[model samples]
Target: MPAEKPSHFGASARRLVGRLAPYRMYIAISVALTIGGVVLSTLGPKILGRATDYVFAGLIGRNLPAGATVEEVVAGLRAQGKDTFADLVAGTPYLVPGQGIDFDALARVIMQVLALYLVAALLMWISVRLVNRISMWTVRDLRSDAEDQVHRLPLSYFDKQPRGEVLSRVTNDLDNVQQVLQQTFGQLLSAAVTVVAILAMMLWISPVLTIIAVLTIPVSVLVTVLIASRSQKLFKAQWAHTGTLNGQVEEAFTGHELVRVFGRREQVTARMREVNEELFDVTWRAQFISGVIMPAMFFIGNLGYVLVAVVGGLRVATGTLSLGSVQAFIQYSRQFTQPVTQVASMANQLQSGVASAERVFELLDEEPQVPDPVDTPPVSASRGRVEFEDVTFSYGPEPLIEDLSLVAEPGQTVAIVGPTGAGKTTLVNLIMRFYELDAGRITLDGRDITSMTRHDLRERIGMVLQDAWTFEGSIRDNIAYGRPGATDAEVHAAAQAAYVDRFVQHLPGGYDTVLDDEGSTVSVGEKQLITIARAFISQPSLLILDEATSSVDTRTELLVQEAMARLRTDRTSFVIAHRLSTIRDADLILVMEQGRIVEQGTHTGLLAAGGAYARLHAAQFRGAAVQVDAEKQAGEVPGAPG
Candidate 1:
């Protein structure tokens, strides 16, 4: 069964954070640097406060006699009918009466503050660099794991999943994760530390002002929580639509010719537009909703800042707090609100990352194909003898291939011929173990196949699917893919055997010619021949060819028939026969319908018996490809796939 979609936030976030564990040393160093930077910067406001004290003290001191005490200056001014000014002088601390600004002290404090800020900036820069390393390593592993998971997944997993969606998860989602980490990780940690440090400093300056400043926190928390909850779902939906949009694009590109041939261009365009519209709407709404967090926090922080300022000014006038203290508190107020707003703003990015994270997690969490065995029995040379003992399997609830038994002796060619949905193509799948059996077992050379490793079992077999697949590489490279590091002589021999050499001789580069992934440079029939060449190079003990020559013309097909005759010598083969000629050459022909073999015999014997095989044989045109639906009606194997 396909895995369920994972929910976003907490669990996914935790899982993503857990990825950082391997680099804990680096993260710890980064965290230490961030805290050091914030702590150092926090002291700047307080240090500048001392300079404010000096400047204010000198201004008050200059108004009195040069050596007079603050009390004497206040009394003398009181006696001179200047009571209000006297009280101001009395209330201000560190007042050296009748003295001017302390130039030396001011310079010292200013330089100290400058030095602290410079160091803080340097630390922050280092912290950001460290964060980049952590994120790079983490995202690298994530991509590698996703790729490995894709390889290990069963074909059934892909049958239920769109290739485009899987591609989006591995590409787009992981990229988003990287961005989020780079943008937010260090900053979030720094902002949190700043908030805490500022609160402490504000309390030290005035407990009353600290109380007023913190009163806004509950409101900020409320706004963040409310907006985060709403926008999280929007972000999740946004990525979901992104995957859907990608799937549509992949499908359109994959079937570009088919769409034009069928005149469904407008239909595909309309579907894409619909998904695009949904993606746009959700992304806009998500950004809008999360955008509210920063503004709301700013508003609340401003109210708190204003209140603290008003209260601190009164306290300074009343002599309960120094003017420098009030100034420092004001600086703290600005610093505090900025970090809070930043934290709130980062909430949106965090939500998007979490959404992407869970999408990645869901892929990782999917049950992989049954794990490979810890140990597989070793085998001598395989002679291509295969047996199916009461094998039962199905795609869904209903059983298919139930209690089925069959055997192919060494060096025999078995041809499977049946109508559409008669399980003709399944013979190859069973032999290859693409789909596991539900009951009984299959064996290669009398060793239970499951006991042998999948690699060991598959290594002895060669296959050519109905669809011809090619990669972007030279013709020689494509053929060599079947057997890595094949000698030039070996490659030439295989290509000649598959009739690929004849076509290659005329091309501009011959065997050295490079083809695109789609192999658009060559004709479709030529592409099939290359694939046939690839299979031949594998040199497997057993061969499974599913309409391997279906795309070629009569001339090429006949040439391939001769090549196949030579290739089939002294080897077991399974041919999903689409033409009468292929069936006639088989040592045995299987007539299956609904996953059960209806008849089994040689061509002459089956024709003489006049059973299901005869009907299918009668349906196929002599020495030509069978008509699709007509073959099905006459039970002559209709489609390429099971």
Candidate 2:
């Protein structure tokens, strides 16, 4: 079954943080640099304030140097034995009251402030680079773990979910996580450091002003909590709707031919419109609620700013606070509020990221396939023999197969014929252990099938399905997929046996032609031939052919039948055929209805007995005879044959 969707944000967040365990050193360095940068940045306003104080002092006729007197100048010149000193002091400002400003000292202070800012910029750049590296690597590991988890999940999990929805969890959901980690993580960290550093600097400047500035922090937090709480459900709904929308698009496009044939364009578009509308609704609501946080925070921050300015002005007038200190405090107030606003803005992204993480963690936490026993022995070589004794199974509460017993000895071809929904494919699945049986046991060569590893059991069986899937690769590669290390000659031999060589030789790049994702470059019949060739290359002891030639033309069916005959020559084969002619030569034929064997015999024996199989065969041939007669009557002239 598909995994339950995760709803616990705290657990998911913890899991996301746990991904950083391997990169602790890198994260530590990043944090250190961030702190250093914030500390240096906080020093800028204070240092500039010092420069302001110096300019004020110089302008107000305080702490200026005294001008050199004529005697003092002559003594300095005699002591130094140089006239340059007199020239330097001739137009120099005096360090005395009512003198010019100390331009040299002011220049030095400005340069000091500039240098601190430059260092801070460099540290912030390095820190951001480190953060990028850490986030990207963490996401890489996350994607890898999710992919490995997918491989461990049972087929039933896939059976229950839409392919696109599952894919969204793996791709779009991970992309969301990556975006948050890459962009929001650094911002949040910087905001935190900035807020703390700015607070410290503010307190140092004026405790009262610091208290006034910090009054907005609680209000901002409270507003943020309320809005974010409301938006969390909206964000979750938004992603879920997005996944559903993606699923619809994927299904519609995948079955494009069917849609066109059935003229479902209007219906499909209308359905997608509904889902799109739903997605848009939740998306906008989430954005609007989260968006309110920043401006609200700004409003409260501005109120605090007004309070600080008014209170600081009063203190300054009372001579308790310096003008420079007030200037610094005002700058500190803006700086402090800025980080809070930034953090408030990131609240939405953080919420979205947590939602995505929850989805990903759900996939990771799904129950994996049952594991093999620790001391499971390797499969021993055996003559092909399969047995199902009182086997029972079900998809739900209703039993699909019950008390089903069958046997196929080595070199025997057992043909299974049935109508649709008669558990034909389910039987194949059960035999392959794709789904564990609810009751009874199956054995191969006297050894219980469950005792063998799935890998070992699957290695001994080859399947060719009706769909005939092929990947994007050369034809040679597709054929060799069944046995990866097969030689080129072996591949050619298999292709020749399967009649794939007939068409492949005519192509521009014989056996080397690359196919697209669906292998649509070739006809369906040709694709089926390629799949048969793939099965040929495997050379398994047991073979399962499930409606393998049901989709092909008569001529292609002939070729496929010939290939299948060769494939089943020395193996125990189970053939599920809709066309009775294809299995007329089987050693045993089982006719199934409602998931139970209604009759079991060879074709002639069943015909002579006039049972269910005989009735079905008669109906098919009777239809064929009537069609032939109709064609003959249409082709005949008035009196030509008489």
TM-score of each: 0.94, 0.90
| CA lDDT for candidate 1 | 0.87
User: Residue by residue across 571-613, what tens digits does model 2's lDDT show?
Assistant: 9999888788998989998888777988898999998997677
> How many clashes does the backbone of model 1 have?
3
Q: Each candidate: what lDDT?
A: 0.87, 0.84
For residue 548, what is the lDDT in candidate 1?
A: 88
Decoy 2 TM-score against native: 0.90
Tens digits of per-residue lDDT for model 1, 382-476 = 99998989988887899867788889999999998776777777767978888788889998999888777788889999998878989999999
